[model samples]
Target: MDKIQNQVRPVFPFTAIVGQEEMKLALILNVIDPKIGGVMIMGDRGTGKSTTIRAIADLLPEIEVVADDLFNSHISDYDLMSDFVKNQLENNANLTTSLIKVPMVDLPLGATEDRLCGTIDIEKALNEGVKSFDPGLLAKANRGILYVDEVNLLDDHLVDILLDSAASGWNTVEREGISIRHPSRFVLVGSGNPEEGELRPQLLDRFGMHAEIRTVRDASLRVQIVEQRTKFDQDPNSCIKEFCEQQNLLKQTIINAQSLLKSITIDYSLKVKISQICGILNVDGLRGDIVTNRAAKAFAAYQNKKEVDVDDVKEVITLCLRHRLRKDPLDTIDSGTKVSQVVDDILS
Candidate 1:
């Protein structure tokens, strides 16, 4: 029964997902250049937030990792390697590698700190003199994606923990003076219904981009979404087969973009303009400027372009800055609108 339950299920192809272009673009941009950080998606309920996220993760190409490593340590990068992998390397051990689907870990709202960050078995340390540290979700999420549904409803402290690891690209566990650190670098994707609540500005700012989605209002598009979903539900395998071409095309596009991203460059003048917008808006930090630059380059790469232009920066400037703006409870202007206005004034 357990084996049957653990069998992999077919995912709805990412290309089949209709609408929510902003959310999809943000997710893709982050995947192309993880240095752009991750995205925060707030939307109406049942707006395909979770489905779209999962589809993108499933769409990603497999990565090679050191076999049997709990952290899914990259095959080469020392920083991304786990301590165990490092020790083996120091002892001149040859590491076996395996290809695996990019991990997509869901953070349940009720998770405790110890569960989220991992815990050290104090007894083993004291008695056996061995560090029996049990890995948690962050450890498993290395070189993958950590998704938090209903992120606004999650505890603030937990949100901090996630953002810290996402920003620093590492998770450290300490117990009874035994500290264990491992690579926890992963694309941090969080989605929630804005109707329920909103993450605080500080926590929201930690996310690289903000994408807002609403339920599809067009009757024709609505019908298409429903029919497509019905088809997928009726026969997941056949439905996936139907869109296999589009899915493969998109997956290849992402791979190409990732390879092209490093060569993608942005103009210095445009970067100065990005910072100007942030300054005019009184954005709290340089994250807005930095993310905008990275996202613009990623956007360019995604389009198979070698250099970022004004349009590329324009396309992502709002997403990169919207969540970082200071909240004025009395102000009526929407944050996104404010960002757009500033961008237009400066970049135009």
Candidate 2:
């Protein structure tokens, strides 16, 4: 019974996911360049938000991490290593390394600050005279992905904490004057159903991109999606087998994009136009411009391009800038449409 309970269930393949291209693209872009911040997805319920996010774990290539490290610290990159691991390296201590799947941490709505940010073991610290820290979701998510579902319903305080850590690329925990800081760099993906509620604009703008999806309007496409899901439910292994090729191909594309992202440059003129759109929209800060630039480059890298083009910018501009616009309750036009209009006007 214990063995059965421990068996891992099969995950639905990312390649098998139907439609939701914008959402998929946003996720891929974030994977290619995590520094693009993370993606915020808002749409109707049952649109495969959670499934799509979970599938990303299957798609990501394995990474080399310090063996036995709680933070999944990178073997060589100091930026990706925890303070504990860095200290060992500085001391010239022998370190073992292991390759593990890129972690995908699901942040539950009911989780407390201690659970998300980790806690210092006060009893152990006082008795042992050494800092004993227990890592949390943020630590486990280092060099990986952190997903928050129904983010709008989450407590605003928690959301703020997450945003602060994500932006700073580190999580700090302090208890009884003992503080522990570690690398918490991870792609922060969030999804929510808009009908339930909306995230505050200030909080929402922190996300690098926003993908708004809707229920499939096409009857045939809906039927196809239903059939695919039914097939997977009936025979999970076989369904996974069917899309194995596409999944491998996508994984390779993502890996290639990650390596190529640094070299993929956007033109100076394109940069000016992107900022112009932000300026016209009255975007609060330079985040819009920075995200748009990074997202465009990431998109180009995903397409295996050497340089960014107008088409690449066009493909991602809406996703990058849509959530940054201020809400106009009096205006009936949606934010996506407003961004599109500006893109067309400026790019035309």
Best by lDDT: 2
45-90 per-residue lDDT for model 1 (tens digits): 8899999999999889989999998999987798899989999999
Deviation in Å, model 1, residue 154 alpha carbon? 0.7
Candidate 1 wrongly placed segments (more than 4 Å) = 1-8
* Clashing pairs for predicted structure model 1, backbone only: none
Report the poorest 10 consecutive residues by lDDT, candidate 2.
Answer: 1-10
For residue 262, model 1's alpha carbon misses the true position, in angstroms, by 1.6
Error of 1 at 129 (Å): 0.8
User: How many backbone clashes are present in model 1?
Assistant: 0
Taking all chains together, the TM-score of candidate 2 against the true structure is 0.97
Error of 1 at 157 (Å): 0.9
